[model samples]
Target: MSTYSYRIVNVFTQGDDPFSGNPLCVFESAESLDTPRMQALARQFNLSETTFMLPSTRANARVRIFTPSYEMPFAGHPTLGTAHVCRALGLAGDTLTLEMQAGLIPVYATQRRWTLQASANGPSG
Candidate 1:
């Protein structure tokens, strides 16, 4: 049997409301899980987005974003949530870079707030 660890967080929260922001699930570690398993887990969580953390050669860590139906190259809330989890788990510091399918993303944290640098080009024109 295999046990996976994960954390649930709210991004873009307003005030102290727990349900104020978008909910995201971030898997603490996904080095053993494959694409199919990751997809299934995302479907099981049924959140707007789920993130898996993996080791990265180019950045602090590698992140994969997934929805119930398919995988996403990148997403804002998920990126922020994952960065928060990374910092909590000692995987990264206040400023770290995440390697995503879309590209390498730079994330920064100030206190409890997290931010990510967006790409110049949009997904679609």
Candidate 2:
């Protein structure tokens, strides 16, 4: 197996719950991605959350969100925080698509912060 190359970046994103502190992540990426390595990366960060960026064989970038415990399909803070890091690291565009386990998540961004909207491709109520 090959190594998953990732960049550890610190970020902050406010969640609905006031008590929920800003999430952080050590964004991981490489030629391939898997669960065990993803879990290990999350553990290493030991933050409110972590993420792995894996571009899908189909289209758009596949993003995996993880807490210290288990992986999450769609998360507000993780989505925003990862976008922030991706943009900061010059890996994002004005508008980008995030392919999470849930589905295709469209992300819009500005110079300062990122805004996420949930749709059939993503989270919906």
Candidate 3:
């Protein structure tokens, strides 16, 4: 088997610079986060959302969004947090098109923040 690498991130999603409340849990990777394991962590952390990075052909990573109970097609916070983590690891470009089940959602990074939004005409990439 091939070796895979990933990281777990804690994101506030909202609030001030210092941050408050529970930080969102994320298992970021170029491969994939263990499915059952990621679910378990979601339960343990109990954040609004969590992210898993999967293999992708896009310059941006293929990402899966999950809640504590089930996976999601798309989510604002999870996308942002995932982008932020990836950028921090020097995996970012001016723009990234995350391959989500919903579509090829584009995320752009500016200064120190990451933002994700959907497009009606976006390709299923």
Error of 3 at 21 (Å): 7.5
lDDT at residue 78 of model 2 (Cα atoms): 78
| Candidate 1: tens digits of C-alpha lDDT, residues 1-125 | 77999999999999989888999999988999999999999999999999999999988889999999999998889989999998999988899999999888889999998878875793221
What is the lDDT for 124 in model 2? 39
List lDDT for all candidates, in order.
0.91, 0.69, 0.69
**TM-score, one value per model:** 0.93, 0.73, 0.74
Q: Which candidate ranks first by lDDT, i.e. highest?
A: 1
Task: Give per-model CA RMSD.
Answer: 2.6, 4.9, 3.9
Q: Where does candidate 3 clash, by residue pair?
A: none
Cα RMSD of predicted structure 1: 2.6
Tell me how candidate 3 scores on lDDT: 0.69
Location of the lowest summed lDDT over 10 successive residues in candidate 1: 116-125
